[model samples]
Target: MRTRTNGIQLLRNGERSVDKQYRGQRIFERLGNVSQAEAEDWLKQRQAAVDAQHANQLREGDEQLFAAAAAKYLTECQQRGVRTLETISYHVQILLPYIGGMRLRDVCNDSLEAFKDARVTEDGVKNITVNRSLEVVRTVLNRAARVWRTNGKPWLSTSPLIEMLDEKGQERPPRPISWGEQAGLISRLPAHLQRMVLYTVNTGARDDNVCGLRWDWEVPVPELQRSVFVIPSEHYKGKRPHVQVLNDVAWSVVQECRGMHDDYVFVYRRERVKNVEDEPVMPYDRIDTMNNTGYQAARKAAGLVGVRIHDLRHTFGQRLREAGVPEEDRALLLGHAIEGMPQHYATSTIARLVDLANSVTQTRDRTTLLRVING
Candidate 1:
């Protein structure tokens, strides 16, 4: 008598799985949730892989690679235009060696916690860094469970819950850049960077926006006789072209930045493409701007230590409040979602916005280190 068994069967939860003989050994493979038709299609693919292997055209370990799943997840993220995929990919690379060879079902909380602990203890990495790495692992697992399917069953039985480290002990937020400190910092910067800092202080545009700005986005407000720049959705955070209202100081900075570079609004001299200099070398490319290292050196030289570039944005917001600019209008000027824009924002036209923007603009002499605040 021959042994009888239902080799490929559907589980109670509607998942199709296979426990069949392959190469004289019992092979068990689970396919994620898929319809009967899709499951059959997957079976064909599996047989094809085996066929290619027997013909010596396929290498071993093709079906058992975890990194392949992560690569597929990254491809999906790129297809959906996920802006943060670069950060995710960076963290994923850190996790590749830890569990890259484990079978999908073998990844449990115990192994994951071990990986996390090793990252903290052995590598001397911070808990937050470990958490970020674990997050990428969890994301790839979740994508495998809910997105990728083999023969109508999920790669992993389920996605284990991944916890994050508590941020109880973290560095304090960057302090707001004070006027005299700002002035001192700007003075220490090279000529082109000085103008860029002035523009950032006036308009509150982010570093990337200011650095990547192009001349083509300028919209001339002929009725008001001033030009404003519109940063497109892909470049800005809000998924809309940020309307940069140009005030007196900001307009002056813009005028100075113009005619120096044909495309990019801001350009600086590139000495070795990474140093401070005095020339028309900075284009709309990576070579154009002085990076964080140069900025830090300039800050230390100005006696304004412990200042980060992002603090400039805080400085702008603080100055707006000090200048008595309305909160609603300030939101508009800062490229934030205005509270009552649909109701009264259209009436609060570009001219009105320019006035508010100018109110926060520091005077020419204020840029001098006349009254430096201790804090």
Candidate 2:
């Protein structure tokens, strides 16, 4: 029996099948013992799949541009909730001016020479910085060739080799600051920044984690009479949840920050603009980064040149080692990736970590072996 829906019919044996021709293609689907509506739905789905496959085949051809592939890569990254989407987008924007118009197949190492030269000479960026941009380009091209497929045809024939610039001599060693240097740098910074720096040095949390720290991540441990921030896997660099164990000094800083902001732990109070919307000025606003204009001015005034925000984390790790804390404890305190270790920590373990962290607080007893070499 033929249904009103085209290409859907009931067989003599009470079976149903969809026999349809879509876009110059035959789609024959046998849906067993199904109703006319089911046959119709099957036909609709099959035809849609065929249409999409055809569209993909048409789109992912030799005419594909680097910009188009980059857009697709970024969309996939955003959909997957990639933590470094903003950084990737920045690299894409830098690449677009050079390879936006270039065909996917044409974006080889040879073609990238001009962009590399421009970045090194015109932009005055280091080879390592240029390498980061190149790495993004390599990632996009690799995804296009290996992952993205259209009608069994890959987006590109092959991903070309992207040579990274040698960073042997250009590499800068970690500058772990001394306690005296820390005092000078901390005193020069603003109150909000000062708290953040202290928090970072105590916890060894990265700049992003420090800046994005929320009150909600804090889990109170009444047994220990303290709280620790539990960073979700999505928010952390290691793709695993990190427990931000606070020592006595870090806990003290946290106490000072309590009731300051409902959302963020550290925040700055900016002066209200004349015609802008009036917002609450009591709790202040979330700080984007500790490496802002105020931080730069403070560092300069304090004569702490070439000192990056990341050095605070280095200082923490250095101090922990100097305090004679165990290597495994240092790894956990610094949030370093430990294989086969569970994310959730017991109260006892938390207490032990807190003790290890406190050892660094009293820098007076620790050796000052960190030589300050300004770049």
RMSD of each: 13.6, 12.8
For all predicted structures, in order, the TM-scores are: 0.67, 0.79
lDDT per residue for candidate 2 within 1-375, as digits (tens), equals 777987787889999887877898988878899877777777888888887667644655546878888999999999999988999999999999999878888899999999999999998999999999999999999998899987889888888999999888787878877787788989998788899999998999999998889999999999999999999999998888999999998999999988878898887786555744665444478887889999999889888887899988988998898888999889999989877666879999999999999999755523234353333
> Tens digit of lDDT per residue, candidate 1, span 1-375?
111233466778778776766655464667767666666666667667776546432222224356677777889889988766788888778777777756556665676777787887899877777887877878877877786766676666678777787755754454666667777888788777888788888888888788878899988877777788888777788776678887898898998777877788887654464555756544544223445666878989988776666667766777787788888877878888754443123324988888878877543333223224432
Error of 1 at 224 (Å): 2.4
lDDT of 2 at 13: 98
RMSD of 2: 12.8
lDDT for model 2 = 0.86
Alpha-carbon lDDT, every model: 0.71, 0.86
Q: Give candidate 1's TM-score.
A: 0.67
**Which pairs of residues clash in candidate 2, taking residues 3 or more apart in a chain or in different chains?**
none
